[model samples]
Target chain A: MGIIVLKGYMIFTIVLMIVYAVRHLLFAYNRAFGKQKLYYNDIYSSRMPKISVLVPMHNEEQVLHYVLDSLLQCDYDRDRLEIIPINDNSTDRTRELLDEYHAKYEFIRPLHRDCPDRGKPAGLNDAMAVATGDIIIVFDADYRPATDMLKQLAIAFADPSVGAVMGRVIPYNANRNMLTRLINLERSGGYQVDQQARYNMGLIPQYGGTVGGFRKDLLLKMGGFNPAVLAEDTELTFRLFTNGWKVIYANSAECYEETPETWEVRGRQIRRWSRGHNNVMFRYFLRVLVTKHMNWKEKLDGILLLLVYAVPFLLAVGQLDAIALFFLHEMDILSGWWVLLFIGAYCSFGNFAPFYEIGSALTMDGIKNEVYLLPLIMYNFYFYMWTISLGFLDAIADLITGRQVVWAKTKRFTK
Target chain B: MASDHKRQIYFARTYRHLKANRAECALFLLLFILPCLVLLLLFYDELTWVMTNGAVWMIQQAGGPRAEISAGTFLPRLGPAYYAVLPTTQPDYSLILGNLAVCLGTVWVLSTGPRKGRPVAVYLSIMLLIHTMACAFFLLGKDLMPYTLEDFSDLYIKQQIGIWITFLVLIGLVMGVLGRGAILRRMLTVVSIMLYSFVLGFVRYVLFLWILYRFSVLYMPLMFFALGPFFDFLYFVAIYAISTNGVIRIYNTKKKGDWVWA
Candidate 1:
């Protein structure tokens, strides 16, 4: 009777798993259905939407030029666009470059900060006080979008329900070394397929901190941001979703960013992100799921994403249980070929699905770009520490202890 | 002025107290080092078994690259098998002591077992996911067995069909409950279905599967939360399922979708 119940439960679980996997596959199909890109020139009409592009910087002298050059070459509506480069407490040539660009580019406007540290959100809020545009686009110093990004983003907003749109961020110098190669693979699974999958299915996804756009009205409605947390982007996203607003994502709106050259730098950036994410989760955990007007599904998704940091530890435990069972139950588990097949089936499904989806989403022609470390991508087991531990621990501390977190900057690099 | 000098004298007393604490800082090594040594000894044979095969045995036995550590906590290579791959890298009492000291210090910082700082935790968790993914990406996505890149397009399609069903159920339930106001209720049904579909798609598809996998639905819920951080795809499905009103039919249901090439 005991064996029968166990096996019966296994059958039930397997059936449920398949049913669930099928559901997600179908959602992705609809998102991809009949969606094709419009070429830059053909889609980019001369009637440019006046965009207020904000670059809030603390000490971003390194990559300001790269961003400026990319902005100058935008595919649509550049004439009506006003570039406000907000220099937040930078005692460097960052200001000089901003001035040089302002001198050369008529659309460039520079603002300097003269206050004690308030952080990135405060910098953005200050800039928003003076911004003038129908559309607001935010970019980090390290990223440079494709020429057609503005045009593509504008077109995506044609749908009235879309409150914001997120663009794709690809590693600009992916081939830098082994570390970057692993990073490229991880990023692909993260932003490309994961974000796109959510958008296609109509779930509210956290915006990419860089490469996102907002309506001026909605921006004001959200009141800039709650500077109390490290990650303001995540906070604003949930707030916007509960208000019956939708965010759109365009995979073709390509932008490139520099991966931290080494793990040490990556570690610092992740620590700040972890702290910020923890703050966001605490502030919004139950609020987004149960109390918010959104259904159980979206809230569950939000909670799960915040809690997803805990999955690795759980899987490690599961692996132990499996190993224990091998010793305690199956002396030689190879006794059944069926077991091997079952393991193969789920393992294959778990591992491979994201790569193809992300790879295809990134390329215009749908050809996969081979980041050579593809084989060693698995070695990153040592690479993603901060995101899980710091993100999870910090989140928990903030929630339990009610300790507030402040924004920490990701030191930018230029090529 | 008298208080300032008195305060300086108080500070001088505290500096000695801190120096005394600093002398005991090296003792922190015992916490992590002791466990590592005990674990090393406990799994000695397994370590030997791995070492005999030159750690190839460890890689194979753990079932792949991601299993270097037994249950992902104690990196077993640091165990008895430490000498097999790099025999010259002898395990010294001091080195073991050092490893333990660093582990203890970090774990102390990490709190219970080095609180696994966010950097170490996220990076390690992501690495494990990538490792699992490297093992499966090709086999599932492109339909290439034993490779990277999988096509989860099916997962998305079926999610849509599930959404459609959920909305039908939700609308029927609401109509049955509030039949008096026909126009207002009808408007709500349409709006609710549209809004709820996203949440429904996410719940049914993503979170459900996550629960199934985490608890091993077959066994117990031992420490599955570790996989929680790496379960990005699972989270995506939950959001997709919950927010969707209906699920799309990726396959005709009449045929085996897995066998068909996209």
Candidate 2:
């Protein structure tokens, strides 16, 4: 029975890996060749919606000025635009810096949070309560949006159905080191291909936490951002989709952000992401299945997207299972057509962003020479597997023990 | 203004996209897929012979143990092929206990030390986990040990052939469908990658044999599982990247404005 279970699991893992491989391949092919579904870029209105740009800062003194300065330079109408930099219990010079910006610009508002509940979601909840805009856009303290980014992101809300809008993120310090370069490739593949293809296919396009915006009234109606949820972005995405609202991807609405330059920082960042994403996954997996708002395709893609963070953990366990089966001399698992399936799965098992997907994305991005760093993502496979698996365990523990989800900030290397 | 110019160039190159050309894709399929099938059919025996001879020569130079090359058939329909045969060493009681103790000690050190979350620590722990499993299997379930050294060599050669075939097909698919370049450059990229794979496979086979001959068969699972074709694909991707870069460079220089804007 034990042997049967291992073999069955091995087969199941292979099938799952193959399904992801095919899904990515289709995404790559579509992004490369298929007619792209356009964003609402050309839909200009004389009367634009009132917008509040929220910059969430927590001890982000090193990188706070870049985002604030960029936001000041944006071309949005001064009467309609407001910048709120949420100072969430920041100990560094962040509060002072925001105050300086607020004194200089009438539109720049600084919200200071001295209370114990400190995180992006809680800060956002507080900021949203006082924000005087119909649409609320969010950017991390490290992000430097382009002068027209606000207009591009806000234009999507002109359509009543678009609950949220996500823009493409380009790494500003991609050439810093090998880690940053690899991350740049991942971001390229993720946004340029994955998100764009999902939008093109009329599937679910996730509203990433930053470089994105949503209807403030809609979120407020849904009881504001959940302070308990670490992945407020993913949770809000599912909430909006399952409630019949759309999240649109604007590929042209590009912004520059810093990526982690060191392996340790990247690992912690990935682990935190995995934990938060998995928590959201556990909460919404069943809801996506039963939600009447989503069609069959939307539900399928939604479930797959939710399970994205969990794949590395599953693949890691699958590796251990393969070893156990090998020790048990259960080589019969590789018989006949199983050999092909096993080999295919082995090739596809690492990095959720497959080589072809990234390669095609880089090609489309007109990025030359950076594609050479594509192979190094193999090392990242092990890194992500172990770290994400730990995060998965953390999430499972969170569910069982009802542990408080602390927002672990990613170490900024901008200075 | 300079940044704006740079942005314009970047967007010009990226925003202008390419439509799928069925003819180019078909040609790519034929270019790679046909050659791979042809090579497998005509030169499978010869390729295996070269790999077998290379392994034997390397093992002899190492002067660790006596190595012999023997002919064997994996699937009867595929015909017979030459493979390296090495004497298999079963782990003695002392060896098993010693390795197990070492694995446990390392695991303890890693878990307790400051290197707990480090990648190197994680990598070492994974390697130790496999070695520990092998030690346990040798200690508790020695009778269930399925593969000997010869069987492993046979499987390695068979999988190496499969790897080569798949490499060719995948490279073809990626470069043909996703890649933008002149046909000659694309073909050259495929050839370069195929050559790299051939050399890599030979060297890795010899290295695995040398390790297995010097050490016991206890490390067979580690070599097969950890340091196998997966690592080979890493360099394969690297070569593909380099080639793709070359294609992009040429396109940017010559046909910069030819992109079909989305």
Identify the runs in model 2 with alpha carbons over 4 angstroms from their true place: A336-349, B1-14, B30-35, B38-46, B53-77, B80-82, B92-121, B139-144
Cα lDDT tens digits for candidate 1, A225-322: 66676787777777777787777676667789888766656767765676676667666777776665677667766776564444333333334333
Count of clashes, each model: 107, 0
Q: What RMSD does each model have against the real structure?
A: 23.9, 3.3
Tens digit per residue, CA lDDT, model 2, B121-149:
77678878888888888899876788888
Task: Give the C-alpha miss distance for residue B212 in model 1, angstroms.
Answer: 35
**Of the candidates shown, which would achieve the greatest DockQ relative to the real structure?**
2
Task: Give the Å error, residue B198, model 2.
Answer: 3.1
TM-score of each prediction: 0.55, 0.92
Interface CA root-mean-square deviation for model 2: 2.8
> lDDT: which candidate is best?
2
The candidate 2 chain A region of ten consecutive residues with least summed lDDT is A332-341
- Tens digits of per-residue lDDT for model 2, A1-415: 9998988887888788878877887898889878888888788788889999999889999999899889989999999999999999988998898898888898999999999888999999999999999999999989999998999999998888999999999999988978788888889889899999999999999999999999999999999998888889999999999999999999989999999877778888888888999999999999999999999999999999999999888878888887777666665354222433454454554465887788878778778888888777776777788999998999999999998988878788877
Error of 2 at B81 (Å): 5.8
